[model samples]
Target: EPEVTQTPSHQVTQMGQEVILRCVPISNHLYFYWYRQILGQKVEFLVSFYNNEISEKSEIFDDQFSVERPDGSNFTLKIRSTKLEDSAMYFCASSEWTGELFFGEGSRLTVL
Candidate 1:
């Protein structure tokens, strides 16, 4: 079975710096999403992308965050400025219009 894959399994950055997380979802999947979990917190939805445009986004996806599928296969999330609170395990997921989501091994971001 195919699964989403993320690059830079772990990242360390200073507060105020920028970071980019990259992912490649299942080849035939249509919807892609970004979710994060702060250390011991619940998984929080950030944004969903479909048909090459943003389909839905949570308030957490503020101006500091942005996502793009520069190519048909690779999706990327960029944080314009990192904050201490931004440190978390970011997961990349993809699925069909309706079904279970396949998530990549999360990329852990550490901001100090």
Candidate 2:
């Protein structure tokens, strides 16, 4: 089966550095979402984009965060400044919402 692809499954960054986590969403899906799990916490929604613009964004998505569909095949999340608390599993997901989702294994961000 085809799968979502994410880069740098594990990332280590010092506090305050910029980081870009990348993903390739499944083709034919109409919705894309980014969620994060802060080490042992429940998954939290950061944002959802559809029709090429943000459809919804949680409060957690602030100045430090941004997302884009840089091309027809790629979606990306950029963190302008990293913080220790920012360390977590960042997941990119696509769904019909029709039902569940196909999630990239995830980009694990580690800020030290």
lDDT winner among the candidates?
A: 1
Task: Summarize candidate 2's per-residue lDDT along 1-100 as a digit string, tens digits.
Answer: 8788999899999999999999998888878889999998999999998888988999999999999998877889999999999999999998876267
* Model 1: CA > 4 A from native: none
Q: Which residue runs does candidate 2 get wrong by more than 4 Å?
A: 97-99
Please report, as a residue range, the 10-residue window in candidate 2 with the lowest summed lDDT: 94-103
lDDT of 1 by residue, 1-112 (tens): 7889998899999999999999999999999999999999999999999999999999999999999999899999999999999999999999986468999999999999
List the lowest-lDDT window of 10 residues for candidate 1.
Answer: 94-103
What lDDT does candidate 1 reach at residue 1? Answer: 76
lDDT of each: 0.96, 0.92
lDDT for model 1: 0.96
lDDT of candidate 2? 0.92
